[model samples]
Target: MSERVTPGHSGGLITLGTADALWAGLTNGSAVPTVSAACTCFPADVRAGYVLLGGRVVATVKAGGGQWGVPEMEVRRAAAELNVVKMDHGDLVRIGPFGGAPKQKQNDTAPLRWRQRIARELQELGDVERAAPSEGRLHHLAGIDWRVLVEETRDRTVRAWWLPRAVVRLLDAAEHAETRWLQAARTRQNSTAAAEPPSQRRQIRAAGGRQTTSPHSPTTAPRPYNGELKELLYSALSRKHGISRKVAEWMCAVCRTTPATVLDHCHEHGYVRAPVCQSCNTQERPDHLYSNDIRVASHYTRLFDTHNVDWLRHWHRCPGCRTRTTLPLPHLAAWTAYIACRSLRPTHRAPRGRKPCGVLRVSWTGSQNAPRSCLLTVTVDFCPSGEHRVLAQIPYREAAERFGTWLAETAPAVAAAAGPDRLDGLPTQPRPVIPDTNSDGQALF
Candidate 1:
């Protein structure tokens, strides 16, 4: 089972975190928005010599491990810089939304999952070459950075490597995943190489970087995301959004790969919702209540004039038996009047059984004595043509002063659709009964 991340989890979110966040960003088509290459690469070595001269490991730890004058302190400091928790887990671990004395164990499942998973994959893919891309190392075999390769049997257990733990986990997970996973990674790599002008690919090959492919490209259709792979993606999202890992997993299954920016997970299931941003999430979370603005009392009172407008208890049927009970219309405080501009549809409760909408015609009947006499018409053409067709024309005004005032007082529903009422006493129309319409918009049951 995948370990989950929670604010109150054993070590909080940190326990579920990897050494770096950048790896997650890169794989997700983002670079660490805040972290920089100059930041210390914890648990990983930084070839300072090559970094300064080679512009790679400008800020990293050193290998042949021992101690370089308070380097541990520097690593801890870097963890603070990244806003992740840092603590002494045999060798000083880092993870979480906040940095402090780590409350995690050396056997942290988050790291273990990556180490064991990759070791197994490498054993299966047959060990490839490990190098320091920044070190200018030359070797044959499908080249991989030493940052990810396990140094020895015991080394995998130690949480120390420059590459982000997430980066390592994903790279290895590919060994067992479908070809697309690896193909996506390769495509990313090739795209990066292609952008480097001239022959960056040739340079990589010259530096002993061998082209790699998926283990086996099946001629058959690609498989659905396996549970394990889904968990990994979920964890990445959890790390990003601070939601529980399980919630993220559920979101990945229901919504999409990424979580929303604010809520992060389904409010009900406690998992990632849908296309996370506000614009997309509107469609992503159809039933999701994004705000309480419509529910608050203050906002409600301003929406209606209790004297001029009133709500009748309306009920279609009872939740049980699906039959009309003693229930009346639920209380609504002129909810339709809260409609903001730019919205084609008015704000109202989603009705059940059928949608109640019709045309509102306001025409000038010409004048007997009044010249600007406008007539207001509220027409409901239910079913248009049906056995139970409902055609109702409401009261009209012959000497109406303005279209807005007449519609607001007599046909408030029409005015509410055209625009929201500005003040009290302005009419907020209610929907009239219409014929049944199925989900497909077909008229009648």
Candidate 2:
């Protein structure tokens, strides 16, 4: 008959060990006996090992055996069902799901092996909790599904199970080996990203293009980097009136709700005009390559012809804002209607540290500590035919009374339509803060 095998007893395998010294020691039973600490046999130089149960050696780890870690969750449930303390020896069994039963199992007098403990735990927890309960990466690495058969070799030996320091050393080595590669991959990705042009596209591709980082002052602190990116962004195109995409993006051509995403370019010169949002890029810009500006002056060549009394017969709309007044004069006329309502204002000044906004998000109440005020500015953009003259900015409120008096005398009907205290014309020459009355407070009229 074939030799009868004992649970965890490997007298036969001991003679066949690859190492001569280890084999000799096992053959003579001179091998230092040790214990299994789940993933590995601990206390080095030990050839024969015992798998313990409640302080007793129920089976040998054998001359040749597999190893694994006891998952934390399994240990807890098994201890609870087996009536063993969860923290004590609960994580001991780290050996694997062996292919088959041990030739014989040595059951401890306490009557609980890993299988009995886990089985009782599973039964008590019921199907829902027992099947594929929540587990982590470490649990997958250490715990195996198979259990060792324990009844074949029953014993009264008792020993507590704890992972020796040797096992911890082995785990640390494995972790260090894997982490090196993960860290290297992250560094390489950052290098590749730094090569691209700076764009404020920090949000994930799937996150609807929302910004990833915190926002700061649009002028002093631009988004995605800073004003430093402005020059480089349009260096290839044009730099005459270069404005950073960050500041320009805050305003759109059509509406302030959406941000400008593209640089508005001059079609004829292939130069950067201004930063414009995506909506204006597609909708606001004219289709034709030439005269593509949205301004009404470009489309209505008749207005540029000599200004005549008849020109006032047809009411015109302001090209910039489409604001029409009852003056019945050409919108491009030298005079502007004096309205009593609030006018467009600027919050730009040198001492205050705020520059003029190329594109503005007008509603935000800016820094409380800084000097802030909005003044109405009017431009009398009168250019001779065939000549393009940049209109000078004249303080509208400062000259309101003088301009209004001139309009009242020159165009009484236009002044009446403009409401009271309205300016229907500008003086041949400009002056700042010319009140309706002289220093004596008498009516200048």
Candidate 3:
């Protein structure tokens, strides 16, 4: 046969009912008495009060009105016996008429015991500092004292999750020291840079100080006979003579020479021997003046010698006529012709003959053999040969009148051939006209 268990009964003992029912029965005086039939004899259907015995309940005899009750002395005795049984079994039990049971008292200290067990296990595993409360023990230890756990135990197996104030203070001190060291290093670098010598500093300046200095000017000395000396000489010459300095000097030097002797030498040597003081003549070779005509002729010869035949071809061609046969005279001869032409009257005509003076002669004739109203004469000679003669005879006024007529007739054609004049805005002058009259009394228009 199997043993049967009932409510509020376990391990062959009767246990107390719920706290609410037990308190109601005790206060209302309706307690029921439960007793083991094998142990003690009691009246049938007897009701009694119950009292606490450790974590269990026990029945007592009822008083009036069928109310269960317990005597103070019996209650004390049962309490002492239950205390002993509780210490022996680490719990309490109860016996009733229906069954023997265990106590239903809650074990309030169970969680703290489990917590201690877990902490020991973590320490053995070298992880106590990292251990957290288990789900089963969280509510149990929610209000427990932690002072003893914190003070007595040292968890060298795990690192602390939070930093201590002393370690933080040390870290702050190291950081400050590093910052100060860096500042000192920078200060030293600046001081060394500033201590450089001035010359070295200049070398390090931007672009080596090229911007600060100006370039040096070239060191050339001036030659003599500058503008000032030229102006002074010009003033002196102008004051002393009415001529330019160049002409005056030339005329003075020529005047010193014997004209007759100079003229003779000019024909033979093509130059006039320069006159000199007696002292200079004895000391130096004589200098001479080359004739302008010979100089001009020689210049052309040199030009022809140096240049090709094309240059000479260009020189002979008349730009206006576009004819190579019409040639210009040498520059010196042209200038002499121009001067002679300018000096004579336009009416005068050159004559042709040799006179008694051995020079060529020229005269101009009027309408008849009239004397003052008729003729004018010119004599031509060479300086060295002393040849003087009449060269030509013609009517002076008649020649001029004829030339004017020729000019009028040719001017338009010459002007058109020469293109526009650059300076005078006029055209080139024309060749003069010659007039011829016969025995008939008609004038040649």
- Per-residue lDDT over 1-445 for candidate 3, one digit per residue giving the tens place of the 0 to 100 score: 2222244432222212222232322223211121222111211111212222221223334346744333333333333432232111111111111112223333332211222332333334454345454433321111111211321222473222111222212222222222233333345445545997545432111121211111111112212211121112222333554332222122112113211111101111111122211111111111111111111112232233332132222222223211212112222122222222324312222356422232222333332213246543444544235545443343434433433343234343432333223223111332121232211111111
Local distance difference test scores for all models: 0.25, 0.26, 0.25
**Compared with the true structure, what per-residue lDDT tens digits does model 2 show for residues 1-445?**
2222234643323221222222222223211121122222211111222112121121122223543112222222322322321222221222212223243333222222333333333334444223453332111111111222111111263211122222222222222222222233334435545865557323212122211111110111112312222213234644545344243424333223333455543221222334433333333211111110112222122222332221222221111111122221112122321222114323345577954322211111111112143122232222223333322233333234444565455545644545433233322222111122111211110
Candidate 3 regions off by >4 Å?
1-311, 316-318, 328-382, 388-445
lDDT by residue (tens digit), candidate 1, 332-420 = 11122122111322122344654333321121222212223422222222222332322221122311223335336643653444432
- lDDT winner: 2
TM-score of 1: 0.18
Better of 1 and 3 by lDDT: 3
Candidate 2 runs further than 4 Å off: 1-249, 266-273, 287-445
TM of each candidate vs. truth:
0.18, 0.16, 0.13
Tell me how candidate 3 scores on lDDT. Answer: 0.25
Q: How many pairs in model 1 have backbone atoms within 3 A of each other, for residues 3 or more apart or on separate chains, i.e. clashes?
A: 18
